[model samples]
Target: MCALKTLSLFLVLALFISPKIQTTTFQTIKPKLSILVDNSKSISYFKEEKNLQDFIYELKNNTRVSDKFEIENYIFSSDLQVSDSIDFLGSATNIYKAVTAVNKLNSEKKAPILLLTDGNQTIGNAYEFMSSEQKVYPIIFGDTTTYTDLKITQINTNKYSYLNNKFPVEVLLNYDGIGAVKKTFSIESGGKTIFSKRMQFSKKEGSRIITFDLVASKVGVNYFTGSIEKIKNEKNIKNNTRNFSVEVIDEQARVLLLTDVLHPDIGSLKKAIESNPQRAVTVSKVADFNGNFSEFELVILYQPTNVFKAVFAKIKKAQCNLFIVTGTNTDWALLNAQQLGFNKNFLQETENYGARYHSSFSTFLQKDIGFEQFPPLKDAFGILNFYREHQDIVLQEIRGVETTQPLISFLEQEKQKIAVVFGEGIWRWRAASFLRSGTFQDFDQFIGNAVQYVTAHKNKARLEVNSEHIYASNTVINIAAFFTDTNYKFDNSAALEITLTNKETKKKTTFPFSLRNNSYQIALENLSPGVYNFKVQVLGQSHSKYGSFKITKYQMEAQFTHAAAFKLKQLAVNTGGASFYSDEITRLTQDLLTDETYYSEQKAIVKEQILLEWKWLLLLIISACTAEWFLRKYYGKI
Candidate 1:
């Protein structure tokens, strides 16, 4: 009776374990998909590699997540880099090429390709390529409009304005529009419409050009926004509008020109700085500085003697930027006392040599110090050479045999910033060189660059653009901006407005906020990947500044690797994600709806029935108890 009971128990246990073993089988599903693309013509504005990469990512990712299909991506084009292929590695973008690749894919698996393009097929068998696959679905972004766009070719005007004077303005416009229509354009300046005119398009086959002028009533630099009447089929609206900046100077920039003698270099520099009459640059000798030096953006010192030490000391204490020219009579004693000393070898004597008559203009002379006519200093001697390398020197003269060096340098001694020009004799070029190089305008542009560079920090309120970054579709872009104001502290009270405009779509978005530490943040999100322009305007007690921002599409996948499996799934499809081009991932997932295929494709299954083997653990405890009991029963435990 005990033996019969044991057999029956064994049979019952076997039946129970058999069912568990049958249900523990594992399965894997690999979907097959193919990619078809048309790449006959080349896009001049953008790269084709980007389009292909985006399509492949979508195809592989879509197939990876779906249990029903594996992908075989392919491309067709005149120049074939990859044929119809199931492999992840290869390149071909033409339609016929894609069909060839499709034919090579495994037949048993499903086929699909997320095809993408701009629809500019110029070469290859387009008919054959398209006919082979009726399942091609493409996502396009460019080449919707064929009308030639009218764009602002160039804009030239004074950077700053002289109050209540007409500023010379020039603008160039180009387009290929219907000759029948006349376009009227208007310019908005400093919150007011300053100029408007009617212009006709060229009747000829080419582009039309337009030029005009504007007047200003402000003392500071003013930005102008221009627009032309939009046509019925305008290619791009962004091209219809333009921006320019002009400085209106009611009173000219007062320049305190301090010099011991009537040096020709000083004359040249003064001519350059005073080139714009609107800037009130008062050229005063050093003798009068004690009572009159307070009203100048720049203090230009030309070969000043020790007698002028008091004037320089005052300028230094005022914390204003200086452009000091050194010569034989330079106040060495005062310079040493003020810690503005030059190298001992800065001066060297050279023979009187004459340069060959080439009649050339030095790049330095063209800089904005405002000289009307920079005549080259003729054959003169007593040359003083600079020993130190000073990159801050805005422009260097067109040299002969003399090795040119930086005469002006920046000194940061005793926690002060001072600009020093080591020598004189720069004047001889202006009184003489002007007849040769036709480029010598009324003023010296070199001094303009110098003053601008030195006083970059003095301007209390300023604005500038930081970076132009790019991202893919639905991306968040960070636009960095810098704002500084010596008069007003940046805090919650400060207001700034950011305007973003899409050149392609002619869409505008504006955001307003406050700032801190002369800085602010503007986050741009959910934007389509393309080239975008952003304008930042800051309104403060001192001045208003405008800056631009640019954003680009993220095209590379170096950051997306196998480690980012989850993100890869999101890139292609989520249950049903959107894809570009002739890529058909939908067919691959078709089998997912069927019961047999659904059961067969078991990739997400968990293998372990119950994780910890608790029954085995319980058996171990029972075994230990049995051993203990056996020991006590057989060995007579105490």
Candidate 2:
């Protein structure tokens, strides 16, 4: 009876649960995507009817047709002022800042970006943002031609102005087109047209240069706008207009100069240095060397009385260039040791007892050589002169030299190219020129040129690496270096050693390199991945350049793993769900979203053997019959 009851229960459970198990399958769910617009400076160029806000409305309705994605919106210009009711990422329209914000998005797992830009990245670095791993879809909308229009090339004026003073002004204009084209242009300053002219350009050349001279009549930074007549089919009109700000100043490169003794020769030299703004030279009589040397890039020491060794040492240590002016009091032995002494054979000595020195433009001081002759001055005492043989240096003097020196020389020193002026008496040239106009009255220019030559060698050296984590497996790594030595002539044979040092262990390895252009590539395959500091030293015969490089800590997994897995899991848990493995994807995706009776009804199915029911019962009946037969047979008639 118990067996029969268990069979009935098993049959009932199977009948109720089988249909529910076969009811449903699974499917995937998609998330919403958001779009942000930058309605800042770039938008102002377009009319109000064609603004970015209206454009956003168009994208919203069009994107709504796709049921796979939900859309959210946000807008920003100078600041994040407003956000829609939807949860959206706020953004700054500045190209660089916007890229940074989008690159950092953590919530949206699979998102797309749409960017509309003029390609004019003014405020921030757009290229840097795009160089990263972010996916950017750009719709460029600005003018493409760079320099095919008439533009202002240069503006020459002071920074401050006087209310009604006439000042010299120059404007340079260039037309960027092949073939000759004639056009009329005008210059407007302070809301008034100061000059206008019709110009012509040759069709064969790239650009034409136009010069204009105008008078300043305002007392502020006068705004000047230059515009040429608009041409038909011109692609961009905005670029055709050029503007500049010019200030009228009471003084220009005004220098206060002093020398220890009232020497005319020294005065001439100082005056020559301050001649042009190119590199102004100023001299102060240092009764004592207490003032700051920071004000000047170059300083001159025309022989001092009771000169202290400490003073010479201080001058040597100065950040600025120092030109030592030799006099009769200078120690000749020390001068020769310092490589400033001149060979007596090079001197041009005068023998006449009664003689007059006349200043004339020497072939050596010609304009091409960078020297200008001072105005002719007579009655100068004839003296011995020890000068350079280089014709180039001579032309520089003849072009116009207000300051005169008896000796000038150059020395190729270790790590430095030193130029020395051995003798003085330059002030006499200035005094002699004052008696006559047109003698290089610009003594300031002469001295300024000399000083510039001495200090121009101090270059700005800065180094930056392209990447912080250079993979050890990488065969070669690239580095970008920037320096201010525009006139550098690099020697290709120079070699550099780059040494990488482990941060914690202090272990170091060095790689030597021969130059392949201005770049150096060192193999990194042998080095293990870790935080390392690299220092590069360039070896040159005279001077050496040094820089440092840094390698960020590297993790092998960080470079190769899929970054999206973590975010996918977070989305699953936060929504009260479990992540599905790829193997079980078909079931999890199809069934998880289906409505099922199994979850609603409490039922289960089970399987059993027939021996527990029909077979066992039959065996029991046979055994009972056999026992009765045996009892009857044993009793009487078997």
lDDT of each: 0.49, 0.43
The runs of at least 3 residues in candidate 1 whose Cα sits more than 4 Å from the true structure, single-residue gaps closed, are 1-148, 177-181, 189-193, 203-223, 245-253, 258-297, 303-322, 327-347, 350-408, 411-417, 423-638
Candidate 1, residues 445-482, lDDT tens digits: the string is 54554555454443334554444332333334555455
Candidate 2 per-residue lDDT over residues 149-174, each given as its tens digit: 55445456543444455545565656
Choose the strongest candidate by TM-score.
Answer: 1
Model 2 residue 552 CA deviation in Å: 50
Off by over 4 Å in 2: 1-36, 40-55, 58-97, 100-112, 120-130, 140-180, 190-197, 201-220, 232-242, 252-638
TM-score list, all predictions: 0.38, 0.30
What is the clash count for each candidate, in the order shown? 79, 59
